[model samples]
Target: MKYLVREKMFSIGDDFWIEDEHGNKAFYVDGKVLRLRETLVVQDPHGRELAVIHKKVISVRDAMTVERDGEVLVTVRKKLFTPFHDSYRAELASGDELEIRGDIIAKEYDIEYGDERLARISRKWFRLRDTYAIHVDRDDADPAMLIAIAVCVDRLVEHEHEKHEHEREQHER
Candidate 1:
């Protein structure tokens, strides 16, 4: 399945929708504002919450948590960065691990469990500059969970980008 996500859809308080390849609304992202930490709730069209993605305010490394039915589903955090690529680690509640590696700043990457690819996240397939598509490659993949993971990855990347920009400005001052 392919889901299209708007790149600018991460404004802390601004809401947006993830559309299917056929252009039908697939999921709604409700951005929560004025909170101590960033929070986004992914819901179905009928308004039932599917998953919640929120930042961990007290983590040593920048981290985000994904929850379903109010239970912690997984935690995603930056593992490291290289000149050519960036990496993130996802620890699932069931003791499984997933690794995300790629040119994340450019919105291109893959979510993998061991050697198997679960989903491919990319923007090159889209014509619109602000639109990117999340392609779930595995038939057993959970579309909503994968979408929430993509949302978390984007927010984490942006958070790091803004922090670095701020540091650069501080040195320039």
Candidate 2:
């Protein structure tokens, strides 16, 4: 079944928290809408299959985090994408984590960000400074991937500051 995906992009914000169904509170992304899936297979904490609802869920109202330098930076809204058998990969930088999303993961790749090598490819990568958001070809990326990349662009200034600080430290030594 096909569903209509909303346009309220979700990303890491200052205040974010996620509460589980059991009233347990966790860090969730704020200022973003969650994309829900059409079918939800809710399982109990004990791993027992609980309920399956045939619903039209376009996004998941959940929070996702990528760690960098032992710091939790951005909180991403979880939107479950239907796995397309054919799709290219796109890499994004969020503070210190380089999130790559696609059908096939490209590990050990270099991200050329604003004339600087940002991060090494993997499930995660170190976010580099001095990165700029280049115009990515729409044909080359999916909507969700584009959203992730746009978030990275938002953090480019922060990365630049970090890069400058590191350079200054080197000169001091």
Among these predictions, the greatest TM-score belongs to: 1
lDDT of 1: 0.91
Which digits, one per residue and each the tens of the lDDT, describe model 2 over residues 75-150?
A: 4332245365312222223444333333222222333334443333222321432222223333343322333333
Per-residue alpha-carbon lDDT of candidate 1 for residues 1-173, written as tens digits (9 for 90 to 100): 89999888688899998999999999999999888888899999999999999899998899999999889999998886556568998899999999998878888899999999999999999789899999999989899998888888988988999999999999999
lDDT, candidate 1, residue 159? 90
RMSD of 1: 1.2
For model 1, the run of ten residues with the poorest summed lDDT = 77-86
The TM-score values for the models, in the order shown, are: 0.96, 0.22
Error of 1 at 65 (Å): 0.3
The segments of candidate 1 whose C-alpha lies over 4 angstroms from its true place after superposition are 81-84
**Model 2 residue 60 distance off true place after TM-score fit, in angstroms:** 32
TM-score, prediction 2: 0.22
Predictions in order: lDDT:
0.91, 0.31
